[model samples]
Each structure stands twice: as structure tokens, then as C-alpha cells.
Target: MRRLLVTGGAGFIGSNFVYFWKKKCPADLVVVLDALTYAGNIANLDAMKNVPGFEFVHGDILDTKLVERIFTDQGIDTLVHFAAESHVDRSIHGPDAFVRTNVTGTLSLLNAAKAAWLDRGSGIPHRFHHVSTDEVYGTLGPDDPPFSEETPYAPNSPYAASKAGSDHLVRAFHKTYGLVTTTSNCSNNYGPFQFPEKLIPLCIANILDGKSLPVYGDGRQIRDWLYVDDHNRGIELILEKGQAGETYNIGGSNECMNIEIVRLICDLTDLRFRERASLSEKFPKALPAAGRASRELISHVRDRAGHDQRYAIDARKIKTALGYHPKESFEAGIQKTVDWYLDHENWWRALMDTLCFSKT
Candidate 1:
């Protein structure tokens, strides 16, 4: 069996990818190493707790010794690194953690991978796949096309800057040391297990609780939304077929403004809840009063500092080269995501009460 070490496997995207990977390739031995930080909840991977060919390590990527030990002891021949400080607002509040986890931690992993693979020589089939975000490309104007692998680094927020630094490290390691590296810069991903701090989940959770749905600034900032499952499939494709020393851009080709996304979620929530009440004779809460649609719950707040106005990805390369196309459209994906949050309120509510997220 091929041994794979996945860092940050408890985070949203990482956890989804881990679950999908284990099911898709049952022969592969998967070991997840996560720090279990505030955002990295172990509950995300509870379903896989007893699966065969899988193991979990509660650890941080910043610890070089632990990383090296995993690589050496696990006979890890492949790496799918997803660990990073990814929240833009949190990064702004405290950039020190971002630098430590994203920049320094990435370097440590590269060094460990290089040491582990170098001794095996070039004939060995070893690879290091780095998961990244398109925020590293900074913002685009209304007329500007989507970002491609060729786009220059123009990160804006502290989170993006940290990720950009890590991307550079991956490139340098591939060029200077032949570490057999591949990187995929993806757009925003939404699905089950996403921490409630993000926009989609935050809105879903708050709307369910009858609280205000905060919208940053005018809520016109646009982002490409790729379903978490689609994003995971792209990453798996790249790992198996993408060339070494190459970067691929992954996206769903579904771009929508923040306000538009919020409205869609509101409409979906109303439909789901209204139907549920009809069948179960629950609270039977009346619809919004006149001029008070669910949209009324939207409360414009201060925009984040250095918030990117728009982010879109040019995924033509991945499409043509790898024959990859997203299976779920934005409408279908959002509905599924909304339903997941609605059905699993306890999963997210536990997180909210534990984290004590502030609406301010």
C-alpha cells in the first residue's frame, strides 16, 4: 500500500479531501497530522476514526521533528499538504501565527520531504502536492479575466501574503533541490465541515438561529465558489497526473458577488425551514413582515482591511490537460451545502458555543 501523509487533515478542505481520498483509494494508507487548533476540529474526522488504512496524529506542522518522524516512520512516499493559517480576518488580527504556520511550517515540511526522498534517488515515485488559494493573486478589476497559473503574485491580506510566501518556497524547493513538487491555487470552497467563521457557513448558522446576517461593506466583493468535493477531485487529479515543477489553477467557473450568495442562502433557508414546519407542525414561525424579507436580516458591516474585490480562476489548463470539469453547478452545490448545515445544526452549534464567535 502507498503511504500518504496529509497535514492539517482536520481543517475544512483537508478533512473533506481526506474522507474522499480514503474512500476513493482504499488501498492507500492515509495518516493525518493536525494541530487541532480552534478551527481545526477533530470532530470533522469522526467518521474516519476507525477506518482501515487510516491514522490520525494530533500535532503541528511547525514541529520539524514530528514532521520528519512521520515521513520516516510512516514510510510516507507521497505528501498532500493542506495545513495553513487560512482565515483572512484572523490573519489581520494576528499575523504572527500565519507566518509561523504558513511560511515557517511549509519550509520545515519541504526540508523533511527533501531529506526523505533524496536518499531514494530519482527513480522513486515520490511527490509533494501543496494546496493553495487564489487570494495569493490579489484582486481583479471588473473587466479583468480570471487568474491563471501564470498570474504574478500580488497578495493583499496577511493570509494571502503568508500563502504566497509558501507558494514561493514550494517553487524554490522544486527548482533548487528537485523535490518533485506540484501546487494548486484554488478559489473559495464551500461545503460541509467548513468552520462557521467563513461567509457561507456563518450566514447559514446565523440565519437558522434568527440572528443578523452580517455582510461586509456593500457586499459586492466577488469570489469564485468551487464545491468542496469538486476541489478535492481536482487536487487528486493533479497529484496523480500533473507534472512536477508545475502549478495548476482550480475553480468552478461560478463567480458571484457576496450579496448574491447571501440572498441565495436566505432563500434556501426559508424554503427548507418552511417545509419542515409544515410537515412537523413545529414553531410555525410566520414569514417576514412586509418589506422584511429574509434579506432584511442582512446587516452591512465594516469591510475587512485590504479585502480583495474579486477573485476568479482560469482553469482551462486543468480542464484541457486533465479532462477535469466540475460536476456540480453553483445552484446545486449551494443547495446541498445549505441542507447539510440545516440538518447538522448540532455539529456547527457545538463549534460556535465552544469558539464563542462574536458578531461584532
Candidate 2:
């Protein structure tokens, strides 16, 4: 079994990956390192606490000493690096954190892994898998083809720029130092346990609370939506059978305009709320009212600074090479996502107080 160090294991996608890993390889030693930043919630990892072969360490990836210690102490054979300041609006307002965490933090992880896993003949064979985003390809015209691995870096936002830098660093490490590295650039992800700050969860929470569902500009920005579990499964596949020093693009093959996504969530939430309300007369009428009032709650706001208009991934390489394809269609996946938020009220209630930080 592989001994893996997963950074950012307390955040949305990372936590999903952690759960996926535990279920698939219970005997593997999985050590999670997270900074527990505003977006990182310990509750995301609550299910793994009692599971054997799993350990969580609350720490920042930028801490060189601590990262190196974990690498050496745990004999970490694989590094799945995911820690970063990922929100676009936050990056625009405070880019220093993005650069510090995404670029410098990635550099630190690469250095530590190189130091610990060099000398493969005498040490365990190791792999450094860097998780990244498709925003690094910048915006696309409505007719532009989906982004492929060869797409040149033209990141428009600070968050995307910082990730681009990290991607380049991983490539440099593989080429210059002969480090075994693989990187995956994925599209927007949505699923359960996602921080409410993101689009899907934010809309779900606001719809539930009767708050205005804010849409940026005309809300026509297009994004390919990947189910979180599908993305995690692709990562697992890469870790198992992928060639080192290669990059993979993981996508959901589901593309819709931003407004379309919000509308769908509204329709789904309304249907669910109506079903529940019919069962109990004591249930608040406002709940059903607000659910039906979803479309009216849609509000158009100023667009984000330097917001990319569109992002879509062409994931054929992974599909052709590794037989990896997304299993969830947008229709089914979104219904499940909305139902998850509705059923897990207590899980997201604690996160609602932090909504002010999620400026879209």
C-alpha cells in the first residue's frame, strides 16, 4: 500500500479525495496536512478520525520544517499537493496570499519531496501529483475549442496566475531534477461537503435562506462542471497507473452557463422544499414560498475583476490513455448535489456564518 501525504485534506475537493482514498485503500497510510484556513474545516474530515491507517496533521504546507518532517517520518511515498488560496475574488483582493500559498507553498513541497525521494534505487519509488485548475488557460470565446494539455498558460486572475506558476514549477521539477511528477488540470467541481462560498453551495444555501441569489454580470460565463467524486476517482486512477512526468486534464463533459446552473439549483430546491412542506403543515410556509421564489431572487451584480468568461476542458487524453471518463451527467449530478445540501443541514449551518467572506 502507498504511504501518501495529502495537503489541503480539510477543504472541499481534498476532503472528498481523502474519503475516496480511505474507502479504496484502507490499509494504506494516509497522512493529511492542512492549514485549516478559513475554507478548511475539520468537520470535512470528521468521518475519517476513527478509521485506521489515516492521520490528520494541522499545519501549513509552506512550513518547510514540518513538511520535511512528515515526508521523512512517515516515509511518504506519494504526495498529492492540493493546498492553495483558491477563490478568485479573494485572490483579486489579496494576491499575496495566493502567491505565498500556491506558488511558494508548492515550491516547498517539491523541494521536500525531492530531498526525501531522490535516490530511488535506495529509497521507495515516489510520485508527486499536483492538482490544478483549468483557469490557467484563461477565457475562451464561445466557439473556442476546449482546453487541452498543450494550451498555453494565459491565466487572467491572480488565483489562476498563481496556479499557473505552481504548474510550471512542477513541470520544471520533473524536467530539471528528474522528479517523478504528474499534474492534472480540472474544471469547476461541485458536490457535497463543498464550502458554501462556491457557486453551487452558495446558491443552495441562499435559496434555502430566502436570500438574493447573486449572479455576476449577465451571468453567461460558461464553466464545465465536474462532480467532485468523479474528479477524485480520476486522481486515484492516475496515481495507480499514470506515467510520471505527464499532465492529465479531468473534466465533467458538462458545460452550462452560470445562469443556467443557478436556475437549475433554484428549480431543484423549490421542488424538494415543496415535497417536504406537503408532508407537515407545521413546516414554515416561508420555506416553500422562498423555494418557489427562486427565480425572483436572482440578482445581477457587477462582474468580478478580470473574471474569465468561459472555461471548458478537453479530457480526451485521460480518457484515451487511461479509460477515464466522468460518470455523472449534469442533470443527475446536480439533483444529487442539491439533495445533499438539503439533507445535511447541520453540516453547512456552521459554515453559513462565514458567508460574508464569500464575495462572488
Residue-by-residue lDDT tens digits, candidate 1, 1-360: 678999999999999999999889998999999999988989999999889999999998888889888887888989999999888888888999999999999999998888778844535579999999999999999999899999999999999999999999999999998889999999999999999988899887776656788788999999999999999999889988899999999999999999999999878877776557541232223233121356668899888789899999999999999888999999999999988887786789888875444432
Number of backbone clashes in candidate 2: 0
The alpha-carbon deviation from the true structure for residue 341 of candidate 1, after best TM-score superposition, in angstroms, is 0.6
* Candidate with maximal TM-score: 2
**Model 1 lDDT, residue 178, Cα:** 82
- Give Cα-based local distance difference scores for all models: 0.87, 0.89
User: For model 1, what is the alpha-carbon lDDT of residue 254?
Assistant: 93
The clash count of every prediction, one per candidate, is 0, 0
Candidate 2 per-residue C-alpha lDDT over 118-138 given as tens digits, one digit per residue, 9 for 90 to 100: 843437789999999999999
Task: Give TM per candidate.
Answer: 0.95, 0.96
Off by over 4 Å in 2: 119-122, 278-287, 357-360
